[model samples]
Target: MASETIVPPTVGDQADCNEVNTCHVDEFLYDVEEVEKLAKKGKLKRQYCLDCNSRNITAYYFSNAGTIIGVEMNKECCEVQEKIINQYSMNQNRIKVIHSDVMDRSDIVASSNIIVANVLDFFVDIEKHKKIWYFFKQHIKKGSYLICNRSITDTLESIGLSEELIDWLSICKPCRQENEIFFDLEDFMDMHLYKVN
Candidate 1:
């Protein structure tokens, strides 16, 4: 199989996708690395992406991942992801890019072993944010890993961030796995590895 260097979207590629799905190459790579470590430990069998916008991550997983599902609500992003899949001749049976809201796909969310949910704050409103988080808290099966850029805990007061959601986290009591690699993104990104209870 031909391997292309994992490159971030260029100016032209950015135009192809929605503004919400901006090309954050370094952050995307960090998300991939965090999951890759778990995959190496045999902890990841089926992986899911909440806001999958990276072609590189998709390519890497399809090479050896057990089951990879990228749930992208953005139609344009899905098209870009699908093009990469088609170009690589990846096995569609193992890897799928479902163009739909993550909340609409409960079965996928419930069955995922590792879910990489990048910042979902861009797309949904305050109410929808609460609803989606509630859906995730309820659906994501126990023992599954939830990797998100934002803190699930209420470290600060922000719109759409609900106490009920944080309450659920406290109720479930998920263990936060730490990373040795530290990022200096000015606290713009906080990587939390939650092993669901």
Candidate 2:
């Protein structure tokens, strides 16, 4: 008799649309005008946002039927996501929001062009930081960009985490001038961008 075969699900297969449809989450993040704008610009593709920024314009491109792979979206970050989505109503099909825990999900690869990890410091322990870095390294295509943010208090709270973890998140504190609201030197918030090569 032949043995039964068991196969693990692929990244595409593991994502269950029935559990949380994109539209439900979309409604929470976007409005009519914003959606229309995105459609008009033909910028709707794959875009990610950690902390909202005017420079995060890749979202406009991805939202309009462009191919956007991964987005590090949290329930609290939905507002910014909606604002970007609302810019393009016709291209909503280009977007997919994965509601999984960013730190723990192994399915996410480095194939994404834009990786945004906003306020992620709040959720992870120090030991897991290297895994996070390696995870990003694995999935991002060469020359792809990674965006990350961390709050000071968020970092302090992360002290309970491992030393390696703190080093990973604290590598680059974004200049306050670049990000007025989210990047404050004294406040313990930092944003970084990395190009995968």
Candidate 3:
């Protein structure tokens, strides 16, 4: 969101995106109930969704007190999402579909009161994913929330995760680390919600 092209070269530009649409499932619905619970506690505001789809866009449209910025790297994804939003007439000034790498938009990330990253495993490789975590740690404002569907403890071939990042954000729900998503009743993945320290 800040001026100029200071995007990290991974999902930063079109080339790195491989011109291949990395759009995946719209599984944010699974978290909608939990998010609504959190919002009822008056915890949500200015949320950002990374590599997001339309489901969460509608889910978050209610927070008139906040803004929703959906960041996607694929042009087609953004176009499709914009069309969907327009069709729903979510024509509010608070919603934005940004066509750039989430890493490139530090200003947007920093300002967000909460972040929803469905999953980064499908979008980038392990190394790039690690870098993105580092970038998030660098920019996300303290006290903000980071809601991701992957474990921060998940590591590469012997690449240790930084204790600093772990120490910086404590999981809002310890049980989330154990909670698994069932795709056809099979364990798919774990989900986590964190509050930055």
Candidate 4:
């Protein structure tokens, strides 16, 4: 039997969509050393995230995804992944890029071992947020993880969604498993890691 060759993800020409998924790695700063320090202590596995504008985080993840494959979803016209696909031609197969909304894709969520979303609050409304939570509960497999910028507890409390949020997080128990490493980026934002129960 022959080993299959990995190909980079397919990307669109632009990233503009009715809604743009941007993980503002800069807006909410974090300490890189701290995240890496944590990541070194735990298991690092296949991961997924979306709306990789500017190709900054995508490139960063691209480097890491070499050993552990990841799936990145962006708008149909996303160029960040396209640029990365062109620059690191060899890594194209490591990270699969899909053009779709994070809320709309439960399949990807089911496959990923870890999912990270920065500035998730900025992307959708309260209703959409609920739907997102539903996706997390319904699709994210047990033992998988979720990393995000805002506190799910706080967000739920502020939005009067504590009950629902609690139910979901109870299964996706709040956890701190791995260190998140970002190139030149600090883990300034109080990002939380949750493990699905």
Best by lDDT: 3
* True-structure lDDT of candidate 1: 0.67
TM-scores vs. true structure, each candidate: 0.55, 0.39, 0.57, 0.53
- Candidate 1 residue-pair clash tally: 0
Query: Candidate 3 on 68-101: residue-level lDDT in tens?
Result: 9998999999999998777557755778899999
lDDT, residue 86, candidate 2: 71
Candidate 2: deviation at residue 174, Å?
A: 12
lDDT score for residue 129 of model 2: 51
Tens digits of per-residue lDDT for model 4, 1-197:
13644333346653332223322222245476645554344332123345543223323543444433334444544567666566545455565567677766777778877877655567678888777777778888878777767777887776677886575554233434479534333444476667777
- As a whole number from 0 to 100, the lDDT of residue 62 in candidate 3 is 36
Model 1 Cα displacement at 193 (Å)?
Answer: 0.9
Tell me, by TM-score, which candidate is best: 3
lDDT of 3: 0.68
Please report, in order, the local distance difference test score of every candidate based on alpha carbons: 0.67, 0.50, 0.68, 0.58
Q: Is candidate 2 or candidate 4 better by lDDT?
A: 4
Clashing pairs in 1: none
What value does the lDDT take at residue 176 in candidate 1? 33
Give stretches of model 1 more than 4 Å off. Answer: 1-64, 154-157, 160-162, 167-189
Between candidates 1 and 3, the one scoring higher on TM-score is 3
Candidate 1 to truth, TM = 0.55
As for lDDT, the candidate ahead, 1 or 4, is 1
Better of 2 and 4 by TM-score: 4
